[model samples]
Target: MSVDNSKDLMMIDNGEGDEPLSQRQLNPIFASVLEARLARRQVLKGSMGAAMLGFLGVGLAGCKSDSDSDEPVTDPGTEQPPVEQPPAELLGFKAVSVSSADQIVVPEGYSHAVIIPWGTPISGALPAFSLASTGEDQADQVGNHHDGMHFYPIDGSSTDGLLVLNHEYIEPRFMHLSAAGQSLGSGGVPAFDAQVGRPVDEVLKEINAHGVSIVRIAKAQDGSWEVVQSPFNRRITGLTRMELTGPVRGSDFVKTLYSPQGTATRGTLNNCGSGPTPWGTYMAAEENWAGYFRNGATETNPAPREHARYGVPSANGRYGWELAADGSDRFVRFDASENGASAETDYRNEPNCFGWMVEIDPFDPDSTPKKRTALGRFGHEGVVFAPVTEGQPVVCYSGDDSRFEYIYKFVSAGTYNAATADGSLLDEGTLYVARFNEDGTGTWLPLVYGENGLHEDNGFYSQADVLVNTRTAADFLGATPMDRPEWGAVDPANGDVYFTLTNNSRRTEEQVNAANPRAANLHGHIIRWAEQDANHAATSFEWDIFLKGGDSGESGVATNIGYDPKGDRLDADNVLSSPDGLWIDPDSRVWIQMDSGATDPFGNCAMLVADPNTGTVKRFLVGPISNEITGITMTPDQRTLFINVQHPGSGTSGAEFAAGNYVSRWPDFDDSLPPRSSTVVIWKDDGGVVGS
Candidate 1:
């Protein structure tokens, strides 16, 4: 019934510098659940149900620890050295159980804390935050929504590192004290008339809060992980200046009235899941950006085909950012405007700025991010690259984060040279779309110029046309429709590619297929594809459904995921639901993160670990109420895990909220401190490898 059985940490409240001390033992509630599962195995061992796999193979499931197993917390100062581990070996990683709570929960011997929360000021000069602050105040602080993150260890240091985190989308209610709680922009237009919408200052404020934040993190010798105050910490928001790069550099499509030569843009927005390139660059995907712009009809030669590729409607802007500034024309032009006096000067090129994969070198804080247009984009959620090897094409796979969109891959033109471990060799590449043939096999269809259905008569006039309007180009060649693809992670051991198809509601019951079986699909599944013979540039691959979500018993059979109907591992018994963010640790254990939206009946989202080699799943941690568990990664040493809890208590309003009894008061539940959305690290009490 429960997983964690650890006792609550005894916190010292000395008003300053005091931290919580964990009492090393399982949480009582989780201890009981583990015992029940063990006891059930004993009773059913010889019974009719025992005839199943666990009863016939290896041995029956049983509990390993008892009352005598209660271990004492050891001081980290005198702890022995951590043994080095191979990438395929788990070392001492153990799947400890954790107690379930409406708020954040972790396993025994592990501790968590909120490191940085929404609206937390990064700049020392910015004023401290108050939840009651107006939209103006939110501008100077950390953005409201937090998503994908990466932890890079400081060179030659064991306890210090850098954190690059995405702020994702903004929450208007929490950011601005608005009455209806929605952002009040007049749809991407300039607010020349104060009566039009939210002030331009407000629009710019939100834009400035929607990108990435970098901070220094440290794990003290005592085993406590905290944010280190330093000048390296900075925020890159929607208003931040950025430069463009790649084959399409200086292209006409990228040209804007603001930058006629197409060299730069404002910022990255709607960022979703991400990956790290072989050369240590962070690749953050911008998902669902089509909703942010408004289209004005004043342009002369609008490209309808190009506009449809990005889902830009020929009407007013969606988010209304134009009314805030005079050149507000820049905000709503993604609408495929061609009403310009001449073809050379038309605004149809506006939509080209977005949908490209952006590569940010986190190490070089001052470097301009490169929008790798060579890797065609369509609501990108992630860019997972195959491991680099000498003379092998550097390949990266990505999922288009929209219902019925297609998955894509980019194969480098030059072979990956381990000699140059730097990323320069990745500049040129060939992009391909996927086609899942009937009979279970699939092929990577090339979207190259002059390829089948890519000619001028097919709507794509040239190679630039195919790259700029990627979606229509894919549609022209008939790429298979996938169920709302999200994040992707590659298994280090087997090299299997796992992607999350975060439920799509548009499919009707009759449309249900083996890959996407459910109509409403409240519970999503993890799809793993193994490229043909480890060739990242291969043209074909085989796939299988690794796991699907549903309650056990007769209900889960519909998912056909090899679920044990009468076992304790049933979906109802286990809390792992709606897999979203994903990562594969050194040992190949798939770490799953969830983004439980409105349709998710589960209280809050959580994280779990699954041994892909064995299909054994275990819940790891629970997020704060109303929060999404996202951005998971393990330190190179595998001694620590970093995860983000975003938008906790999101639905609370002025009328129903309270200071002490709010929807969630995580990390400081007793009203001792104000709570904020944050990233946390969970490690064992003995300073052992995390998850061991």
Candidate 2:
């Protein structure tokens, strides 16, 4: 559904001595299921009543309306008849959510297998993965957790491309030493590690496993996708060197012992959902970046106030990398210290190196990654740009992947010139925070200088301060804090922005408001926005909830579930929850991927699809036991879909081996092969549109 961009001017900040949405109880009329369902029905069809949804003084008539002209209207107290379900097949193949296996199960015509797994050597120089591999193999090869990824076509090559995948995190057991090829923790420590106060080598290996990998893939004449051996298969891990770009480059906040000018940093960490820029660069977001350091109870940097804003607690050394060499000095420097002699001479600036958007040129392996620090740092899940418009500012949206965090956008300072082939134009941009108003309109608050009290004693002293303490700056500006925002994608047919707010457990009823309306949001929702006048870089927009995840049969279904593309409202019976990775396919089909870990009744994580226009959502595929379905990218031809099955045996520990039950023995078809984390491609046997 399209948004009414003409309604962007009525935004009101809560800072005008007015009660915050958190303070006011929801209006009883809007809170009713009948009202909410009606509102949602209107939302699904892309329209809302002038009186009810005109909160932001928006022109309700301007919204694209879903004409429920054919369906029989029912009373509020009555139930609607079930709509006819689509034939349960994807390209003539029945798609089933495999329940009893640790594998990707498909119907009669489809087959799946892994081309590469943990510890697999990318090149001859890289050591092969030992059956009982140590952390060393992890450094030289792929890491354990294979999550979100992208498939890029080779120049002039069709049906053949390089798959750039993300290894989100480490599986210490499989990565390190263990008898059954997996160990939770070792009974002994190496001599070098014992003296360092940290697992030095192990830490370094884990560090090296956290980035992206490029593997050449080719489609057989039979339509099956497989990896092709080539030297182009390369790994860009956490230890790989990267360059800093944008306004924050060489800023004092990012300067560290490694690169005093802050022009460079060691590597990317916790790389999650990714974006392929129109200019051909890959944008990898660093998520949960706050947990990587160890400072042990007090500020390591001399500046304590600044360190506090980034969630760098002195006593939180959970990673324990600091126990290695020089304990607190070598490893602790990454802890976001406040006890450094000075900002210029210490590692207090490390946290600033992360949370910003990092861009890599997959075509140019030797190119250094550029951290576009202008995209204010937080737990960035993914970045999705609007289609590039010639001579217009390049616009992109991102979500801060934390409970109550905010959504953001970066608009290039220079207008994009399609004729100009260089992608470097992304280096300069104006970042803005979203402000959703009670009146149904919104505004983008500038995160630049000379505005929003950014350069003064407004808790910041300079441009660097605003960029470094972005969250605090955003808070002061009264930006709307969403419910665990994750990935976002723009509609190819229209400019509407689609983003997922993965479940936020911290919110309570007291915090419930219109925009984010759940307490302990176990079932997350998707919020979509359209730019003013359909312009990518417009400072205003219109927004609404697109889909709500939960049991399709629950009571909240009536109040919580919005419209799916099928022209039916979601009920409490379907068990999809925690909507995470999102992508708008070439045909504008909204693909919704779930990362169900803590609260899943659906058994395992799965991939789902929704036709946003009619609000119709359907289960597409589910992963095997103990794995999350992530990193989905379709081939340029749109017939093949590549997905990552990460850590299928993740929770399995060495102690559990003695038991008859294993967390999972995944990718196990013949049962002779040891389970390995890998990427899988889903395509039609006859070679047609993936979800047909």
Candidate 3:
């Protein structure tokens, strides 16, 4: 049977509806606001039926429908300008319309080029790229499905820099090189059956395809960017050795046969979003790492709660990797079963070694990646640090990417030292989870042991246990559960932190809170908060909705579920949905990227620019069909913008590929060769600041 691209490619929630995580009730004030908003929406639905509502360009309460009339209810040109305009720096960019094109569509006067593709060689002797390349060949080449990325300037020059990118996941239909009529056993064919194990070679190739890649890119004399092979180029794959640092280092929860002391592990998987530190290191987050392991339910000594909480099935692994063990410890490590007498004799604890903020020194090719555990472990979408002060403690914020998960913050115990501070600063810190009160007030509840029932009386025995099982500790403290929280961006001008609450389809009306208003929030929204006294280290905060993403033609009354709507929606550009990736440049301009599915009517996923101060958003660029526009970064001078087009023809099936009915053949646009995810660089035709 062929894979279903629509259901398979989308984000999976393996731990859905296991247990209630939050015990605290929603804030009454916020609950009242939601009640009133829903009441008004009901009244509107009663007064104006679906047909009349569409003509008025007003969206129905819970569903979306096409409007019969193309004309706007009120021409935007007739409205008077606001008394106070946004800063002059935020204006002047022409908005691009939503599109389903096979190319990257940017505003007029801007140009883009595919700089680095999945098979590009970055180090040693340049190797030719072909689908027929062996697993060893891809082990030395670029990985697949480019997600988050950053640009580190070389010698402080914008013209030359190191580009670091994360290989989020792989699309098997395009990765393997099979003969014209080969029976798909392995060799790149995806194995979905538990009885049928993948070929060891195919598994090895996939293992080499799931980590981070760093390459040097430079601007040519023609002002276009090109990948240059340099000594700094390196690839950190799933087989790479990684050190486990911070409080959980050498803990009993992480001890395994490979590393009895638990100080190290092999590989970083599902690296999604990332953050660059002030100390010149890259922090990559490991998301969705649980599915890789398999724990049999029939084990005589089973750890069901542990496996269930992390969403690892007891019967079979997500990819059936353990079936290819073949007496090798490398492959057997994925089998988290009680084959051995004790946990230390098997790989039962291997899953605990992942799901962390891994720190890698991009400048040092030989540096060891450290998993900073004091930041607390969950399904971390990414970690974004607040602007560092000379003497203040470094503060980092992260969001758990599961539906109804909590947002977290970590304040380092040590003060900033520009000359010598490194990942050690992250070793000792206060890991706090957010508790958003109903009255627009929030508090950061510490997850430290013995502070709030996080002691021996509860399941947590020490701080390490609290850090290891962060979700349970947060749940014990009644932290507020939120919609699927994804990437976070910290504003440079102000200390305000913004997070993208990517939509939650499983969230019901009763589960809706002040922060997550919509019952079934299909089109996600962005939420921003300012720490008390403008200090990121503070335990309290004040927040408000920044933007509500939906159809621009939605009625004002129906859309007024959050903050005031005077300047919220960007009607001219039709904005976007499912806001997944976000970045704030040095100039304080907010860049928003989308990861909506194929069903979205606003066309394919796109990127937008937002004025945080004025809450004004405009579409800057739209990606190709079925591709997610992610990994936003810019040059030091802010002249060039880099973004990743992930899985362009994402929902394509293996049978479809064999039958020549693929969804998209992007980047190359050549039907002869399979499409590949790549990094594209955008720059103004005339040398001006991007979005200026």
Q: TM-scores for all candidates? A: 0.78, 0.82, 0.86
What is the full ranking by TM-score, best candidate first? Answer: 3, 2, 1
Model 2 C-alpha lDDT per residue in residues 1-692, reported as the tens digit of each score: 01111222222122211111111111111231111222433433432333223332221112223576735677988876787553232233344542435556654455555656767677536787664444456665766677667888887465888888777776554444422433233222223334435556666666767788877888788656666778777788877788987777887778887788789987888888888887777888887666566434432323333344344545544355555564544455676654567766767677778877788887786788888877777778888888987788888888887667689998887887766745566667788998865445568998876586765545566666677667767766778878878899887766678888878766767666566767777778877766766676878776666667776443122212233333344432235788888998887677777777524456577777766544445567777776777788887888778888876765554466424245677775434334567887776666577776
Alpha-carbon shift of residue 121 in model 2 (angstroms): 1.7
The CA lDDT of each predicted structure is: 0.62, 0.65, 0.75
* C-alpha positional error of residue 564 in candidate 2 after TM-score superposition, expressed in Å: 11
Clashing pairs in 3: 295-314
lDDT of 1 at 78: 84
Error of 1 at 428 (Å): 1.4
* Top lDDT prediction, candidate number: 3
| Per-model root-mean-square deviation over C-alphas | 14.6, 8.7, 9.4
Give the deviation of candidate 1 from the true structure as CA RMSD: 14.6
Candidate 2, residue 68: lDDT: 67
Error of 2 at 583 (Å): 0.7
Off by over 4 Å in 3: 1-86, 179-196, 299-304, 553-568
